[model samples]
Target: MVRAAMESGELAQVAVDVTAEGTDKLFTYLVPRSLAGRLTPGQWVRVPFGGRRLVGLYVGPAERPPEGVALKEIAGLLPDIPPIPAPLVQLARWTADRYLSTFPAALRLLLPTEARRQEVRTLTITNYRLNVDDVEALVSELRRRAPRQAELLAYMARVGGEAERAQVLADLGESIAGPIRVALEKGWLTAGRVARRRDPFADEHVEPAPPPVLTPEQEQALASIRQELIAPPAFRQPVLVHGVTGSGKTELYLRAIALVREMGKNAICLVPEISLTPQMIQRFRARFGGDVAVLHSALSAGERFDEWQRIRRGEVSIVVGARSAVFAPFENVGLIIIDEEHEQSYKQEAPPPAYHAREVAAERARLEGALLVLGSATPALESFHLAQTGVYRLVSLGHRIDNRPLPPVTLVDMREELRAGNRSIFSRALVEALDQTLSAREQAILFLNRRGYNTFIMCRSCGGAIQCVHCAVALTYHLGDDHLACHYCGYTAPVPSVCPSCGSDKIRHLGAGTERVEQELQRLYPHVRVARMDVDTTRRKGAHAAILKRFADHEVDVLVGTQMITKGLDFPGVTLVGVVLADTSLNLPDFRAAERTFQLVTQVAGRAGRGDRPGRVIVQTYQPDHAALQAAAEHDYHRFFAEEIRFRQELDYPPFAHMIHLVISGEDEAAVAATAQNVHRVLAEGGFGGQILGPAPAPLAKLRGKYRYHLVLKGPDVRAMAAEVKACFAAARGKWRASRSVSLSVDVDPVSIL
Candidate 1:
């Protein structure tokens, strides 16, 4: 077939990995005889382009080359890495089209970071195995002549007749290298290279946990998911497991994965954050053991490559990881579960193809006929709306396991505390609760969504807040470093003795963060042990696990953290949870602020009373009677969603309309604004009938030294709007005068406008 095809002038359409605009489409290439029969769609290959070699993905055959253009032959297929599955190739195309991204960008998401760069390979080490039938006899015979060789053979035999070269050298010293070579030459031992996987969890020991008896609600949820797994419909409706916190949603995921394995298919479990991966991995490992593989951004490049290899080679039946794991290259996927399906971390914010893992997972499931389970205590309004509209099968786990009641919540009005002459950051109720909880020898969790020592430093004389040089946001004061830092751009500066605005020593640290809360707790309770978890403290690798371990071991009496500790954490020692300020997220400019506040408050509250003791939560907020805060205090998601959904419907927010956010940014504010206007005009004039809301400054007007202007296009069908936007941009690219100085980014179904 290869020779015949070569003679017949066969052509292959290759999507080169270059990111340039015009290179987004496939280029025709000649199929060399060397790769003719071996080539397949989705295989990564090297090809020549304009006197340079570039990596490209084979996108199947082309009937003919463009009329008069010359085609180049593929250099060779990428070695070691396995070809991407055909289903994934199709899924990538769909993602590219739906997300308004280039083909290469969407394709790149399916590959490991180092694998795409060809910078990593399977690590291998040499091993020596005893070739002699009787190792004891040989050792005794050589003991007199070659003592080192004899000792090496004896050691190898004791360790099951084989040992890695590195281990042997370390044990017997490098002096045994000559002996090992001599032994191999004399036919006394055999040496061969064995693949050594760089497992990220190699240092941790996970004990196998037996499956617990399922509650009736859990059983029903599992049955619904299992039914979909056993026999899926032509257009399968995803299973939405709307379980309250502590309702055993994870158990249902585990059982469904087990069922899929029994049916000879694989499973992918996605968590929202890397902080959650450790606990989720431990649980999955405890249930599935070595059959599980984890993939996430936190893993080293080598570990990621090895794990990808394991998944590609079909060595792992279950994959548990963060957002990108939705593209886990499992060929026959039977299930994909998005744990904490409402997390915004599941959405990619930068670079092109800003896809949400939930959307990608749903598409992948549809493509491969896999069952998608979206499990969340508070589902995203969009997902819950889909469930309500019959697009998804809703399974509810309304009660906690063992009939444990949801934690009782206390709403503390901070205004009353201020009126009562309290100047401290903590309210009287929270301070009292902490004292009682500490006296009772129980643990507590203080939840604050912010992470700095102070929210901002303001000059009392000028009433101006210190702001980031590159961004419009205020700079946070870090007490530990004695510096002011911009969380958005990571720019740091020394804390000035005098206010820059007024030239006066009247700078006041206003608003408390996690760091300040920790300090205040230590000052109030001198003997209390506290641990803080947030982006600041957990920036180093494995820091999250370390802080969590200390809290779990009861070495720390209280854990103070930002939103990182809000979900997927199961600490049984915690009997008290204090929401330092529930209004932090509630006051954000984003429309999802109310919903986010409800989720955060409810999730952090669920952390309490997970053990045998009844739990209590004290939420300190100025707006104690706010619907979101009240609903969260009562553990009533339905009430929050009911009111929130009405607001969304009235305002035409998500679940009622799909929005395409276009942000034009540059160093020159005028150019950016001009480009945004041009984009708006093009959309309005190019046959788009949707509402174009803005050519105004973005909520985050300036970030990382760039001025941003955005436009929001709202329509009923996203695909049609995306098509119109793409075509309009392509046609208007040359007409805009500021096109060269500014850049435009399109986000389909943006999680946050900021």
Candidate 2:
């Protein structure tokens, strides 16, 4: 059968699933005539490769097989599926070329894992809707002969004339299935089936909300964005909406989406974190109702697949989710809004593409001739620089919505607190504010970037701290299980009672995390309800939404969390926000540390005083006088940008010069270090005029059992520098492949150097 199929003249260009460097290209395969029309480009198909059947994307009809090469027949066609939208295919290609990622890796972005296979177990509603006229008579007759049947009929009637069989069983128990069977047999209830989606949020309840009256500032911003939406289908500049925190940026986004929808076009709204998706989606769903579809990492595979299909079918006009939602299948996208655009979370750190969603969204909008709106309390330097250079239009909302005041921030010097004999994690001002907020029946939020119970465990006798064996980082102490775990490598071990290096038992857990702060809050305010929102606490699906919902309903008086709770969350009841440690991220080796610190402080501060009452923030830091903290405390963005941009310019980082970060890693330290130096030499010898730095050990010198080294190239033009770097990498590819242990990865426009 295979020989006969191969002889047939049907051929397809298939993008195999393998993601290795050399194996990223498309291969020609013989397609059976029966599956020719059925299998379209962008549809998943099974193909024989290397003696195994691998799932691959059918990339379109192939021209012809190579001259003397054997063409293997396609193994099978994947189930009922639509071709991935053409725009997405182009975007994926663009992403692959620009980010130095494999085409297959970028293709995987559009195809969810569950969607590779056809058919899913969807729940169908079987059982009748009430025959209203005969219901009373049938019930009257059946009540005498069978009480269970009568009871089933009565229960069905109470549930609004229709119910799924599963719902019926759940409400009445399995024993009631017998009565339901009898009722169906007697024609008392009809049997039917309706396919139901395996929705992850099926258990979650969301109430539709009417759009609010836009503030004057928001109205002006929305009008500008709407104008862009209706503009000519040519290359248009992006619009940067530099709104202050609590300035109704979201309201502007909502109104812009409405305008786009009115034009019969779709929109993609992106938040930076999964924790922010539920609230953002809820808000979008409330305004747009059924027009909203969600995409994020936390969703179950089936839920993601169903949502992707719905989007492709044009069942939804709006997509709201984390970074990946930027690739949503919208045939005619009219608007692309990226909320909290400055966040580093928008950059994919783990994989080859390392693409930034904001960058992708900008290009996508450009290709679709859609209006791109970037909203942020702290915009990235590169984005704001573009606005300043007239490449993007800039709009600003200087005041909070409803004329609410920006929260007054107080920076406490923890050094002073220590000298004054106060050693608690919370400053006196923060404690007092918490007391006042709780007394007023209002809510508060305590933020710490760190998670786990303690930062690290150290023995006072030997001054030795416990660290992860695999990674260069310290092991964090988790509270409940009394174990130490590495955040970078997932390495875990039981906490040592004594220092491993010394024979003394004077070990103590130091530094406060969300867990420690949570424990402290409970101890300090025993009667107040508190909730913790962090990766550990919110690992389960819908946990972010659940925790925020509880806080919104005033079920939680204090919400303690990591950076996840910082952006795009609004709660009028939250009157006070406490920064347990403001200097945690200030001292990282990365140059963007100050920018990140300023953004976090400003963003979390914005979360307060969003309600009717004025809000307050207390920032406790060992270095209260630092420029970033001071600028954040004063709510002075311009000042911070001015100072930070100067330093960035002087240091030749980001806006001043484009950067490409190269990392070489392997189990053998010598091989990895040697490979990194060799690659640097290749670039230098290629006459690339860019400033080359590193071949230095990475901040995380060792991670997940691999020795790591880093190199950076900085140049005035990103495109030119990228081309040169690509050429240099190509020139050295052979040597790298021949080497036994080293591997190289490149990240262009890297978010962080460390």
Candidate 3:
């Protein structure tokens, strides 16, 4: 059969890894006779394109070569790397079609950063093994003349007659290199190269943890999941586990994964943030030992490469990672669990194929006949709508594990505090609660979404704020560095003695941030141990783990951080949780501001009262009577969803209609605006049935030194809209040549327009 296939001159359809516009489709290439039997779909191979060698994915055999065109031969296959599974290749195609991205861009999502760049290889080290028959006699003869050599030989003998070169040196000292060379030369020991896997958890020790008894609610949720795993439906409906905080949702996931493994299949578990990986990995490793592999951005390139290799080789049965883990290379995936399904981080915003992991996981599960479980304390509105329509299996865990009472939330009206002459950043109630918690020696978490010392520096005389030259947003004041920095673009400038607009010494820092809160806490409580966790402080590797460890160890009396501390954190020592300003996210210009505000406040409030003692939350907000805040204070997700969904339906926002956000940006504002108008015209002329909302400046008008103008297209079907967009652009290319100065970006089902 192989000979016949080769004789038929089978042509390979390859998707070259170049991201140019016209190169989005597949190109035909001839398969060499030597690689005829080995070349398969989804295998990475080298091919000649435009007089240069480029890496491409072989996407199976083409029916025939392009008419009257000669094709290049498949240069070679990538060595040591496993071929991407056929299911993932198909998934990439579906993602490209659904998300309106290039085939090559979608394929890149299925590979590790270093591996796709071909910058990493299989790491190897030398191993020394004892080759002599009479090891005891040899040691005795050498002990008198060379004590170090004798010690090295004895140590190797003690360690199973073979040891790594580095381990041998570390065990016996660096002075034993000469002795090792002498032994090798005298035929007493043999050395050979062996593959070594770089382990990210080499320094940590995980003890096996036995399974705990599950609560009734957890048991029922697990049963529902297990039923689907055992006998999935023809068109399997994903299981949406809507459980409140501290309800043991994670435990249900663990039990379901165990069931999947029992049936000889693998699983993938995804977390929204990198900060959540360490704790999640610890729990998974404690239960599954070396069978759980981790993948995230915090790991070194070599570590990521090795972990990907391990997953590809099927050495691990479970994968715990960030959003990208959804595409874990398992031949038979039985289950995929998303921990925080509502998180905005699950949606990729940049580099084209802006896919939501939840959507991708659902597609992959359908392809592989796997069960998907989306567990979240506050599920996204779209997901809940599906559950309401009976398109998903809804399982709820309303109570805590031991029926611990939900933390009582107190909404402190900051406006009232100001009327009472309490002009401090913290309200009177929050200050009193912090003092009491400190006096009681209990830990607390101060949640502030902002990061710098002050949000912006403004001049009192001219009322003009210092802004970043690159972006339209104001520059934040960073006290640690004594400089003004742009959070959006990282542009830094020295503090000015006088206001630039009016030449008066009336510049003042305004708006409190995490740094200011930490400072105020220390000022109020002189000896308080306060640690801040935010983008500024947690930029280093292992910084998140370090701060979290200090808090968990009770060394930190107050933990001040941004949204990083909002979810996936369980610290029993934390009895008090305070939101410095609950109104921060509520005032955003986006449509999902209310939903985000509710999720943030609710998730953060859930962190308190998890220990033996009762927990209390103090939320400081100017909008005390806001419906979102009221619902969050009552711990009522249903109420918040009802109000928010009604608003969404009225405005034809996300859950009611799909949207495609098109942004045109350039250094030249006129060019960007002109391009935006042209795009709007093209779509309208192409016979689109949807409502086109804008050809106006985006909410963030300028970003990273570019003027941005956007248009929003809303309709019931996104795929049809995507098709129309492609056809319109293809038709308009010749008539109105798009300037090289302007660039356009398309985001299908965007999480946020800003």
RMSD of 1: 1.9
Residues 51-124, candidate 2: write the lDDT tens digits: 77777888888887878878888888665457787788889988988887888888878776566544443345
Model-by-model lDDT, in order?
A: 0.89, 0.84, 0.90
- Model 2, global lDDT: 0.84
**What residue pairs are clashing in model 2?**
none
Q: Model 3 segments beyond 4 Å from truth?
A: 1-10, 68-70, 143-150, 274-277, 734-738
What's the lDDT for residue 349 in model 3? Answer: 90
TM-score of candidate 2 relative to the true fold? 0.92
Q: Model 1: per-residue lDDT, tens digit, 13-96?
A: 999988876888999888887776778788999989887888889988998678988567788888887899999999999999
Once model 3 is optimally superposed onto the true structure by TM-score, how far is the C-alpha of residue 561 displaced, in angstroms? 0.5
2 or 3: which has the higher TM-score?
Answer: 3
Ranking by TM-score: 1, 3, 2
TM-score, one value per model: 0.97, 0.92, 0.97
